[model samples]
Target: MTYLVTGGSKMGKSTWAEDLALELAKDGPVHYIATFKPVDAEDALVIARHKKARAGRNFAVTEKHQGLEAVVIPPGAVVMLEDLPNLLANEVFDDGDVSSILPGLKFLKALAEHFIIVTNEVGSDGTVYDALTGNYVEALSFLNRQAACLSDVVVEVVCGFPQMIKGDGP
Candidate 1:
């Protein structure tokens, strides 16, 4: 099962994705691919919160901000990708272009028995961002669309509820 989950910030997307991953994982190994790298105190808090959430969940977490092709996850592991926005940012600002993610995306699709990808919904705030942010939004939008196309199920979580936008429920 491949699920592409998206929602606004703090809208329970991550929690819902985690639960779904657990269900799909069953007795299999659960691997978490974290895209965010902590660069400040606030980032530390976010990391801590994620740690608390995954406590005792038996998740083998890997942080890959770039070079996703080099990931070492076990084949057929249930994979949970925390978010795509940060991954795309790292790729855009540091490593490579947005399309650079395609190979790694294909690799994951081939390796994982179950894949749950989480991303944020953007460009709806109606505030004009600078050129850099505008470019980022456009790139991420493209990335999310690609993910949705690859996914067996695409869901948008709103107010702690998942509204399925594609495919049947798992």
Candidate 2:
């Protein structure tokens, strides 16, 4: 079952995904695909924190930014994707345009195997009024929509609880 978990920034999406992946790991191997780039000290620290949180897990982590589609997804493996939009921002295009993410969306829809996808919900955010920000937000929203369509389960996390928005209840 392909699961898509989405929420606004700082809504504990990553933490939730990690927790769920760890739970799933009890049954089989888990793959943690990290798409975020540490562009600054703060980001680097955040990455470090996540790494520390999963310090002893049996997770095979692949740091493939936009080439997430290239990785071979093992069946029944719980794959956790950190953030689709950030992956598009870092690896899909040098200019960070929305069009670059279209391919990623198509790839996600075509992947019929089991996995867990995570992303930010940018529609409710009011900061994307600028031309660049608005375009990025629009693109991410479209990408999220495509993911939601293919996902067997869609969870919108808030605070720490997950609210199922589609497919089988989470």
Candidate 3:
């Protein structure tokens, strides 16, 4: 089962994805692939909060910012990719390109039995920004579209409620 859960910030996508991962983990181990690269105190605080929320969830956290091909998951392991925006940003800022994420996404699709991918909905604010920011948003939007197409199930979290857009509900 491959699920792509997406929404705006603080829309409860992560929580819903985590719960789905736990449910899928009943058949095997659960791997939490956290892609966020905290660069400041505020980011660190957010990361800490996520860690605390996931405590006692029986998840093995893998802090991977890139190179998803190198991640070796046991066969049939349920994997939760915390979010894709950070991953896209990392790739974009590191090499000024987001196409690098495609291969990694393919690798992940073949690696896990149940993959729960979390992403944020970009370009929803309708706010115009600088060229670089616009590029970032474009890349993120592309990534999200690719993810949704590849996913077996697609969900959008709005006001803490999940609205299924593709496949059967989890």
112 in model 3: Cα distance from truth in Å?
0.7
Off by over 4 Å in 2: 91-113
What would the per-residue lDDT of candidate 2 be over residues 56-92, giving only the tens digit for each residue? 8777888776665577766456777777877868743
Candidate 1 deviant stretches above 4 angstroms: 95-97
Q: Candidate 3 has which clashing residue pairs, if any?
A: none
Better model by TM-score, 2 or 3?
3
Model 3 poorest ten-residue lDDT run: 91-100
Per-residue CA lDDT of model 3 for 1-170, tens digit only, reads 88999999999999888888888888555899999999999999999998998887778999988777778788678988877999887877777346667778878888788988999999989999899999889888988999999999999999889999999987
lDDT of 1 by residue, 46-88 (tens): 8999898899896889988876778898888899887899889
Residue 43 shift from truth in candidate 1, angstroms: 0.9
lDDT of 2 at 111: 56
